[model samples]
Target: MSKIKLLLAEDEPALGQIVKESLETRDFDVTLCADGQEALQTYTDHQPAIVVLDVMMPKMDGFTVAKEIRKVDDTIPIIFLTAKSQTSDVVEGFSIGGNDYVKKPFSIEELIARINNLLNRSLEQKNADTLKIGEYIFEFPKQVLRFRESEQNLTHREAHLLFHLYKNKNQVLDRSLILKKLWGDDDFFSGRSMDVFITKLRKKLKEDPAISIVNVRGYGYKLIC
Candidate 1:
């Protein structure tokens, strides 16, 4: 199989080079750009399978680039890289079609994992028929979660979290890994935010007796069925 194509749009020269080299080492074919305008051009020309963009960039912002990309193709996975910790920043990234977000000073290992996870999910949606978890039926195209007579339209974050947990059902998911991928940071504040989302998700899935989202003490969480 061909290497997965990636478009990386980061303005910081040193950091950009580091990310470019790191992704290349992991066997990804990456096209690097220094700003949103260049990034958008590269994305249009190459049609990469995935995108890694910095929210703060010159000549346009990551959000604008993501919007342009979405106009052409809504399926490509886009991950935002930013340093901001504000809740509004996170919400804005998601509102602009970002598949995931990573904060500044992140580890290469974390970025690699996010890329792999997002790509795997994209591939799965294209190849697999449906995901059946306990009594809930997940429909990827429609982004819907249905159980019995009730249904909820899942936001992108909710859908991705549920899918990840379902894929690893009955297995432990590291709290750090989840917080980083879902909220961009694993600090105390972000941890609390994640906890809130987890509670909401648990309540949403409460109708199904076979499903359980449990915290595994200080290590992580386990979604069992």
Candidate 2:
């Protein structure tokens, strides 16, 4: 059996070694980097199935690396590890493209679990890759939404947001549920970021007049097709 490939970026020497070894024992092919620049390069070179990044690294921070990665590929999951516990840090990580955030001094078990959860969701999404949203064809694994000959590449947040709304099509997808599930919080910043994603999705699907992502005022959103 081929092990899952994971990219881990941490600046602390001891912590990096321990994490790499721990994940390896669990049958992951881990490409460990000591800095954000190396992490970004490794991702570009090999494109791992999932990425684990430390926030404060030399050359580039975790959020910065995530931003770069999102430009080219939005399907890969990114998890951020940091000592910074400020809500702003967490919000920034999510707004920029992080799929999960873990604070420093975390147990390896917690990290492993989170990694597994993200990968499982990724696999499920791939299995149901093609969805017809009105006249648009949404390919989740490829992060492409197509209407006729026109194709739009969606960001990570946008793709996931759309997926959730599609899953609850014609029903009210609660605002709190989306904010918590996608951004990791229902805080003000996360809420605002979610609004941005929804607006973008609206535009992307606008080409198909039969589709509309309607705001439910204080309730949530509903995908009408």
Candidate 3:
């Protein structure tokens, strides 16, 4: 089997080298970039399976790189490495299409664990068939929602949120559980962002009046069909 390819973007030369070497030890083909621009270029060229981005970079910030990457590929897993542990920063990362947020000074083991978890989840998604939701067909791997001949492309997070709701159709999923599952953390800002994505999902799934995502006040949501 081919080794999993990883793109590591960090301005700190020493840390980047250490991370690259460590990941390589675990059978990953690591491509290290010093700045956001180079990171973006490498990402395009290599099409790595996963990306580890440092929040603070020279040419462009990690958030900007994540946003740009999302434009090109919404499903690629992105893990942000940042010293900033602020809730706002975490929320921003998720809002801009990040799959995971790792605070700086983290252990290599933790990072490796996160990578494996995400990769496994992604693989599972790929093997799953399209799901039927009312009149729409939700394609998990493609992050698309199709109704009749019309189709709508969704962001990674949007598709993930919708899938979880659909999986628990007619049940009220706790808000905290949704936040923890999707964002990896249940914070105030993350909850607010979840609300925003719920709205977006509602809008996208609105073509079928029979399908409704009901907001269970003080709780989470339910996908009714």
lDDT of each: 0.84, 0.90, 0.89
- Across 1-225, the per-residue lDDT of candidate 1 in tens digits comes to 688899999999999999999999888998999999999999888989999999999999999999888777656899999998787788678756788988888999999999999898788876644678889888755668889788888766677677778777899988898776666567798788778878878988899988889999998888999
lDDT of 3 by residue, 22-136 (tens): 9999999999999999999999999999999999999999999999998878678899999999877887887787888999899999999999988887777767659999999
Model 3, position 179, has a per-residue lDDT of 93
* Model 3: colliding residue pairs: none
Among the numbered candidates, top lDDT falls to: 2
Put the candidates in lDDT order, highest first. Answer: 2, 3, 1
Any idea what lDDT model 1 has?
Answer: 0.84
lDDT of 2 at 151: 89
Worst 10 residues of 2 by lDDT: 153-162
Q: When superposed on Cα atoms, how far off is each prediction in RMSD?
A: 4.8, 2.3, 2.5
Better of 2 and 3 by lDDT: 2
Q: Which sections of candidate 1 miss by over 4 Å?
A: 1-38, 41-47, 54-56, 67-75, 79-121
